[model samples]
Target: MRATLDFLLNEWLDVAALTRRPRFADHSSETFASVLDMSERLAATEFAPLNRLVDTQEPHFDGERVNLPRETHEALAKYAESGMLAATQDEDMGGMQLPFVVEMAASAFFYKASIGISSYAVLTTANANLLMVHGTERQKQVFAAPQLSGRWFGTMCLSEPQAGSSLSDIATRAVPDGGGFEDDALGPRYRLSGNKMWISGGDHEITENIVHLVLAKIPGPDGKLVPGTRGISLFIVPKMRVDAEGALTGERNDVTLAGLNHKLGNRGTTNCLLNFGEHGGAIGYRVGAPGEGLRCMFHMMNEARIRIGLGATALGMAGYEASVEYANTRSQGRRVGTSGKDAGAPPIAIVGHADVRRMLLAQKAYGEGALALALYSARLVDEQHTGDSAAAKDAERLLELLTPIAKSWPSEWCLEANSLAIQVHGGYGYTRDFAVEQHWRDNRLNMIHEGTHGVQALDLLGRKVPMEGGAALRLLLARIEDTVEKACTQEALREPATRLAAAVARLEQATQACAACSPPEAALSNAVPYLQGFGHVVLAWLWLDIAVRLDGRTDALARGKQFAMRYFFAHELPKVDAWFSVVASNDPTCLQVSADCF
Candidate 1:
């Protein structure tokens, strides 16, 4: 882990140092700080020490039940009991009402310790968020309250065997029972039947009850699949029914834990195949209006996407830290200039090697840049909810534009950092004796989590960039330009700022070229290039921002910040030119291919 700390020290720590700036002074106060400190301590002491044990042990499930590691359960209990579970929730719901920014920072500690274990907390938090937004009074009283109190856990069930990204293809159905729907004396309920696949924390023995927020189609009178997402409805389906006193009843609900998925990583969290209403109809309470389930679920999906990005960033940091430490201490052959014919020279640290330094620097650039991006997006979430109306609207638009990049870019680049981690350790990195290999394996999963790179690229170029008359993209560009302009006045930052400005101009031109295409599909075909181009511009701008902030600091600690800024500009910033060229290129080669060319 020394390598990981080195990467953080060389890259991410600069950003943390810059947080002392007045612009970032809005972070939470006493109560929030206390909660964050407690969370950090628990993550380091309770969660991190068990990461290797949990990963090797893995979660197990019988046909009827699921069992997690004892350490996993203990860590989860500590996490929930400490009020970290309610960090971002509203005060009315027995929460601390902390901002998303604080929650995100707190999450970094958990994720850095063990992403697989941290996921249980993240999923529950997201579930509570969705419930707070859409759940009815009684539903909130029954589900959200207990979850907030750590009495129950939550999971979101969306994917199915046949339906992956295309929700319209889902076969799950909720048919109306007696009198247009079973009019529950407490509230409206439905008979739900569906098989949900790839559900994290689907069935866990740690909590008394598991609440699943499922997406199922409810037929209408005219009923031709309710015409896409409009037909889908959100349902709160519990593992077991609870009595008036909130105690579990005798038998389980129709929901059954069909099987546990043996995944490549994140083994600590049980990913299960669940069958709702397999024996009998599973009783479910509607979260919101019928046909609005997809909208409601998006609330959770968006939050999860950000969390996935942060997790990916944290994993990359861990890998980089581990690799850097190995490079610094591990001794290898003599330097290139030394003569070794007869005289024996002492072995030098691997970190002194040029190629090793290059890999370490690359890891530092990607990991730190990704962390900054994720945190910035999280701060935007806080602004959207708590700021003034106009500020909130701006924050929302910027967030929509940034979310795909935040989710996809880190997953792509940080995984690269993990690969470099393995390379740094040579043969040792490939072995289980060191954690770097595990970090690589774990980081690999994020590339497909939430959404793939292709999916996010398509979303970026095909939808989000064009939404609301391109207002979001325009706002983002303006913000980047503003940062560039501010950096231009700083002598140390002017050159890099100008370079970033040029990249921004190229991106703008590419956006216009794509917009002007006769058929939009022509433009959409280059979405990947566009995404890559946009990400480069964003990272360069962030690096320039860091450089400008560091320029004003004169403290000894700031020397590291100065070195990182110089290294980023000298080595990393030049790649923006190549990315811009690719973005601006009009290669019709892909579109020109015939159907049977092969």
Candidate 2:
């Protein structure tokens, strides 16, 4: 897998070219290699050994402090000591400032080893990143710095019990804490009273304190809360009171953990139901201008969505690797083409079976393709931040268009890969003896985490596809066409190239049809199907692109990539026809159905 990551980063992506850019001028291949080596070594030694432990021994409330296994603490300590927490931040902020793509590649190892433990760092980094972008200087120094250093952890408190994913329906309230609270150095201060649900890493003794970025609404002139997301605001609420220097004041904030959620997987990370201002209003400092909460919080949410996809990808990779190893060793019955009653013949490994190979190839196609997609998006982040002005703007639009796919596609398909891994394992996959079932369970949360499948689908078809007169989709199509043209010239990849080009043209037509339906809402009702088709088409393009790069090569990795790419183009790409048909016709079968018929 490290070799696979290297192939995608160096040979295919030409990440070395990034060194020529001024922001990455100080780095070279060696620096990136060293960072990846350290991450892999740490993950293999510290995190992998504890994955099952953390899953079996989940966090528990002991009536005083939440209790996690001692090994969990040690693993995190080793992680923080590795300095990966600040790998992508600035030197002045105590960061190494590695290229964002390299950082993402480095994280793949840790995520595969243990995503439950790795989640804390994901939220902490995203939190610090948002504050750096939108917080005042003092606020960054106070709240964001420690989290970056891993001295503290962070969580985004967006969903309330009643509101779930609807920010407009959130009932959390924040009131102005008069008496010069607005003049406080942290920012405009407020008294917040609300309950936030599904707050991952919301409470833990691993860090000295927890920083909760809460979204709440303030009362208007009529003393009534505003009715929509426009009235929402973001606040920094710490578990304990901290002074100007980020030191505890020996006094606690009003924030309290109501309970811990028992989850289906990734139980090592604490998911909390938190009651803010249980006794009175919790003291909070605003992050930006009033009523700009979601606008500001998108900084964290979008990044989280991408990372969540990576997490799901890594889990699928782990399962794929496990199943491959199992198939190579586990002796099974003779092949279907061979004699059915060869009593003297020796049983062959499952890998020798055709159906088993098909399953393994499917896993590789989905899992590795997803890895490529996530890394491609990561490079876009680097391009957005460090490329020339025109390139940066293009990168921005590409990233915006790809974010939902990056989030939802892997979350859905990778879970299918996990399921295939389980099937390859037979009955053992259903039991706790093997990790494939656990991998499926952990990856299952990703489709719903950060955002649900339907949420991302609507966002993709409704907003990202048609944005700016469809400039983003057009830009993406141009890139795909460039790849197709090049791949068509390669003898080994011509069919894949031709198939991918046709798929892209169909996708374009479907996008237009969906956008032009008689009633716009009816088309959007079929958004999830649109998402499935669009995702498969995107993967087809990526696979063909990679195969074109490796067409003439005969090495094991190259052959593997070629085979997987061919498998996807043959077995997976055709399904998009059905999905796109639903989108192109703006099918109202589901939308027009009567609810009572159920």
Which tens-of-lDDT digit does each residue in 1-598 have in candidate 1?
2232333333443334323434344333444456566777888998889889878999886655677778888888888888878876766777766667767877888998998899988889899889988987777788888888788999999999888877888878886656855456424677788899999999888888888999999877775457577789988888888764456786688888788899888888889888988866887878888888889998999899999988999999889888878999999966776553223868889998888988887888888778878878887887787667998999999999999999988888898999999999999889998988888787888878677787888999888999999999889889888888889898877887877887788888888888887577777777887888788778777767766656667865455445655666677666666755555565576677898996
lDDT of 2: 0.91
Clashes in predicted model 1: 5
What's the TM-score of each model vs. the native?
A: 0.91, 0.99
* Model 1: lDDT of residue 117: 94
Clashing pairs in 1: 3-321, 3-324, 3-325, 4-321, 4-322
TM-score of 1: 0.91
TM-score of 2: 0.99
Q: lDDT tens digits, residues 249-345, model 2?
A: 9788998889999999998799999999878799999989999999999999988988998999999999999999999999989766544646667
Off by over 4 Å in 1: 1-32, 180-186, 222-224, 243-247, 336-343, 554-557, 570-583, 586-598
Clashing pairs in 2: none
For model 2, where is the 10-residue window of minimal lDDT?
Answer: 335-344
